[model samples]
Target: MVKTGISYSSLGSPDGTLPAPQEVARHAEQSGLDSLWASDHLATGAPFLESTVALAAAAGSTTRLEVGFGVLQLALRRLSWAAKQIGSLHALAPGRLHLGVGLGGVPADEWQAAGVPVAERARRTDAALRALPSLLTGRTTELPDLPGASVTLAPAVPVPPVWIGGGSPAALRRAATLGDGWLPAAITPEGVAEGLATLAELSGAAGRPVPRVTVTVFAALDGHLGGLSQDALVDVLHGQFGFPRELADAVAVSGPPELIAERIAAYAAAGAEHVVVCPIGGAWELQIELLGKARGLIA
Candidate 1:
């Protein structure tokens, strides 16, 4: 069965205000949502919270709902610092934390702010992924190509399952080799099927088990999409993610509960093990409640 999750940030909300993380967490757990997610952004000129801090808040507030970084920009931070933050958050939620890492492509200013060379993000991200598991597990590990000093985290925590996010070939290959799952955003069911096929071939060549698959989509409940026209809804998605108008319209889910449920079922049939839904333009809580109802119709 496919699991259903919700993104906790205000990234896709029509309004800039986001609910308190604690409230969102409690509500999600009570509503039976499987997981809650937040994204990482540095200097995006948007009203976004720091991903790790936000996730920790959510994890601390809910005992059963899994809290995750929808896609944390791991390449932008020093590995040691990133590992420490993740380890600390894991300590709060234990087996309930999911670390979804990605190569963030946005607001060039963010890369500059982090002092990470924009061109080297892929290499840097690969290096971090190679070493993160051991570091988070509190094992002594050598830092790659930096000045000497093997390190180990104090108060060891279990390594959270890492889901790699991106749609590029390199990203898919990395997911096959290094991730516990692949979480791609704004992709169609056909795209997902194709990507998973690539992942399977890559995993086979590497002698690694096939990774789990998850897809993230923007959706809104209600028959009329929170009073926005279909054109306006597409515009919001384009403005936020710069997706082509046609692609944005094609990938976003909107309409009555039955239609939304059918869309999710399509993704499940295409082999997505989890579908993370980001409510686009509506009362966030109401949308979540409706989304849960839609999820129930899938199986």
Candidate 2:
């Protein structure tokens, strides 16, 4: 079965009045959702919370619901610092944290503020991904640039499953080589099939097992579309994320509950092992309830 999760951050709630993370986590667990995800953003014009803090709040409040960073910008922070944060969270909720790492685009100012050269994001991210497991598991690991320095984490916890997120070929290759899962947002079923094929070829060539696949989608249940038409939703998405209309429409799942369920089923058929539904409007609690119903419809 394709597992389903929901985004816990502010992406879908433009009004900025999202419920407390603890409340959201409790609700998700009670609703029987498989996971809860939060995004990492250094700076943004929109209302947002720090991803790690948000996940920690969620994990601390719930027992069964898996908590994840939808895609933490690993390249922006020092690997040691990132590893420590992840390890701490795992200690708080062992066996229930999923780390999704990626090189995020947009808000170029964030990269500049973080002191991460935009041009070297891939390299920095690759190094972080390669070293995180060792650091989190209490095994000594050396920094790539600081060759003589070695460090190990204390009170080590099981390394969380790391999912790589991005749509570029380099991102796919990185996922095939270093990630336990591949996570990409705003992709169509056909796109997923194509990407999975590429991932399979790359993983086979590298003699690694194929990584699990997950996709994040923007969606709204029929009555909860926030009075926006399909075209209006596309426009809003383009303004917020700069996605082209066609691309936005391709990835936007909306309409009746059954229709939403059908769209997710299509993605599962295309080989997605999990789908993270990001509600695209207010009434988030209602959206979560609706999403749970949709998940029941997926085979």
TM-score of each: 0.94, 0.94
Candidate 2: residue 219 lDDT (0-100): 80
* Model 1 segments more than 4 A misplaced: 11-15, 223-225
lDDT of 2 by residue, 1-299 (tens): 88889988743455565578888888888877999999898888767788888898999998899999889998888888888999999999989988898888756899889887898888888888888888988999997635778898887888788899999998899999999889999899999999999999999999999988889988866444454556766887899778998999989966766888898899999999889988776476787788888888877
Q: Which prediction has the highest lDDT against the true structure? A: 2
Write model 1 residue lDDT over 4-25, tens digit each, in one string. 8889874345456778888888
In order, what is each prediction's RMSD in angstroms?
1.7, 1.7
Query: How much RMSD separates candidate 2 from the native structure?
Result: 1.7
**What range of 10 consecutive residues in model 2 has the weakest lDDT sum?**
221-230
- Total clashing pairs for each candidate: 0, 0
